[model samples]
Each structure stands twice: as structure tokens, then as C-alpha cells.
Target: MKMVLFLTVSFIIIGFVVVVSMKGKMERKLAFIQENADNHKNATTPIILWIVGTTFWGLVSMALIIGMFFMN
Candidate 1:
């Protein structure tokens, strides 16, 4: 139980750090897309994938943390 708690907390922290760190890069990508108006094929795939992945993991971590508290 302790290990599970630790892992979930670590995941949440790591995910937060990753999203914050990637903010600048994501912005740059957006800016590039904005400037290049003609090339619109899969221009936002990276940003979409990153957001979906992070959001999914973050929700899973939160669910685990909440479950542990209620189950115990």
C-alpha cells in the first residue's frame, strides 16, 4: 500500500513537471503552425498526443490515490 501510494504520488509529480517543461516547446510548435498557413497536415498531432497522454496518466494517478484512501 505504501509503495502504491508512493508510486502514484511520484507519477503525478513527474507528469506535472513534464507538462510544465513542455509548455515552451508546445508553444513554439503552435507558433510554427500559425506562421506556416499552407502546411496543415497533422500539424497539431504532437500537441494533441502530449495533452491526451498527460491527462490520461494524471487522471489514473488521481484515481489510484483516491481509491487507496477509500479502500483502506
Candidate 2:
């Protein structure tokens, strides 16, 4: 039970960090693209990264919730 709690908290913290980092990264990329007219093609990478990061976070959260339910 303690291990499960530790893992859940760790993953949540990691997910939060990933989200904040990705948001900053995406903003920087977008700003760069805005400053340069020809860099529009690179915009998809940041968007994809943001989507993947959020999706992974959501999945982990759901999995943890389910695991906790079953543990009881």
C-alpha cells in the first residue's frame, strides 16, 4: 500500500512537471515561429508533444485511480 501511494504521488508530480515544462517549451517554439514567417512547418512538433504529454498524464492518473480501487 505504501509503495502504491509513493508511486502514485511520484507519477502525479512527474506529470505536473512534464506539463509545465511542455507548456513553456511550446510557448517558446510558438514565439519563435511567430517571429519568423518561414518556420510554420515546425509548429506541429510542439503541438504533438503537448498532446502526447497530456495524454500520458491522463492515462497514468486513470490507471492509478483504478489500481487504488482494486487494492482495497
Candidate 3:
């Protein structure tokens, strides 16, 4: 309906703006990464750990929310 169309249009517009604005910065960042490959090697484990922990916490929070809704 109208809500879906609004969300679709908003998503497309925001995505287009973000991409257009960041295209140059993205290319620059990629070039920097390609030039300095060793600097980011140590971050993989920590990033993975953070993602896993965050996912677990998010699921737990979502379950709690659902439980509360059902309990009420």
C-alpha cells in the first residue's frame, strides 16, 4: 500500500544519495587498504567476536521483548 511505496521510495533515495556521496571516499579507502594490507590483520578476531556477541545479545533482547508482550 502507501506505506510500502513510501518505504521503498525512501530506501531508494537514501541509498542513492549515500552511494553518490561516498563513492569517492569509498575508492580512497579501498586504495588505502590495498596499500596498507598488514595494518588491519589484527582486527579480524576482535571484529568477529564483537559481531557474534552482538548477535547473541540482540536475539536475547528480542526474545525478552516477545516474552514480555506475551506475558502481558
Candidate 4:
């Protein structure tokens, strides 16, 4: 529970930092996405997309670890 909470907090902090740092620049990025949504359908093409994917995978892995604690 502690580790999971810690990780959740850490990711929230890190995600905050990423968004804070990219606030203004995100509009351009969104525009790019809108313009190239189909052209860049491949996941690896964008760093933000990769970050999002990794974040999601990390959360899933964390959830699995927590689930193990409940299983046995």
C-alpha cells in the first residue's frame, strides 16, 4: 500500500512537472496531432505518446503488483 501510494504520488508529481513545463508548447503539439493524427498513427512516432504509453503500462504493472498482495 505504501509503495503503491508513493508511486502514484511520484507519477502525479512527474506528470505535473511535464505538463507545467509544456503548458504553452502543448498547443502547438495538439495542433500537430490534429494535423497528423492519421499520418502518424504509429505509436512510437511521438515522445508524448510514448510517455503516455509508458505511464499507462507503469500504472498497469503497479496495479498487478498490488493485486498480488490481495490474491494470497
Candidate 5:
């Protein structure tokens, strides 16, 4: 039950971060699109930020799980 709760909270935090980041990215993209209506170029998402964020979260979560397992 403790592990379950930990996983649930970890996922919830990660999910919230993903949602908030995506929302901010989308908003910026929309603003760029609106500003450059003539170009019609595709607004690109920041792949690097997403990659780094995911990697950081994955590492942290794995470390937490491993630590918990060892403690138990």
C-alpha cells in the first residue's frame, strides 16, 4: 500500500508537470502562429525541454522506487 501510494503520487506530479509544460508550449506556439500569419510555417515544440524533463522525472522516480524497495 505504501508503494502504491508513492507511485500514484509520483505519477500525479509528473502528469501535472507534463500538462503544464505542454500548455505553456502550446500557448507560445499559438502566439507565434498568430504573429506570423503570412509565413504559415509550423511552430515547433521544444523537444529538448520535453526530453530533459522526462529524463529527469524518470531518473528521480526510479531512484525513489529503488530506495523504497531497499528500505522494505
Candidate 6:
């Protein structure tokens, strides 16, 4: 149970950080692209991928925590 709790917390924290950092980077990239006249097509794929990955981790973490609670 302890191990599960630790892993859940770790994953949630890491996922949150990744999501936040990627969002910031995406915002900056969009701003830069707006300022310049460069093609911004397909530029959001990486950000979308990161968000999806982070969301998966977050969901797994939540499920683990919930499972642990039910087990206890």
C-alpha cells in the first residue's frame, strides 16, 4: 500500500510538471510563430502528444490510488 501510494504521488507530480512545462513551451512557441511569418502547421502535434502521455500517467496514478483505497 505504501509503495502504491508513493508511486501514485510520484506519477501525479511528474505528470503535472510535464503538462505544465509543455503548455508553457507551446505558448511560447505559438507566440514566436505569431510574431514571425513562419508556417505553424503541425506545430501542435508534439504538445498534443505530451498532453496525451501526461494524461495517461495521471489516469493510471488515480486508478492506482483508488484501487489501493478500495483494497484497504
Worst 10 residues of 1 by lDDT: 34-43
- What are the runs in model 4 whose C-alpha is more than 4 Å off? 1-45
Which digits, one per residue and each the tens of the lDDT, describe model 2 over residues 1-72?
A: 989989998998888887887788787877787788585886667678788879988898989978998998
Q: Arrange candidates, best lDDT first.
A: 1, 2, 6, 5, 4, 3
Each model's RMSD to truth, in Å?
Answer: 1.4, 2.1, 9.2, 5.5, 5.8, 2.4
Top TM-score prediction, candidate number:
1
State the displacement of the C-alpha of residue 5, model 6, in Å, after optimal TM-score superposition.
1.3
Pick the winner on lDDT between candidates 1 and 2: 1
- Backbone clashes in candidate 5 total 0
Please provide, for model 3 over 1-72, each residue's C-alpha lDDT reduced to its tens digit, 9 standing for 90 to 100: 556456545655665575567557656666666688799665355445645655665565556545555654
The residue ranges of model 1 lying beyond 4 angstroms of the native Cα positions read none
Point out where model 6 deviates above 4 Å: 33-38
Which residue pairs show collisions in model 6? none
Backbone clashes counted, model 2 = 0
lDDT of 1: 0.86
- Which stretches in model 3 have alpha-carbon errors above 4 Å? 42-72
Task: State every prediction's TM-score relative to the real structure.
Answer: 0.83, 0.74, 0.45, 0.38, 0.45, 0.69
lDDT measured at residue 15 in model 6 versus the true structure, 0 to 100: 76
lDDT of 4 at 47: 54
Better of 1 and 2 by TM-score: 1
Candidate 6 C-alpha lDDT tens digits along 1-72: 788788778878877787787788878876776777467766767767776787787788778778887978
- lDDT, residue 28, model 1: 95
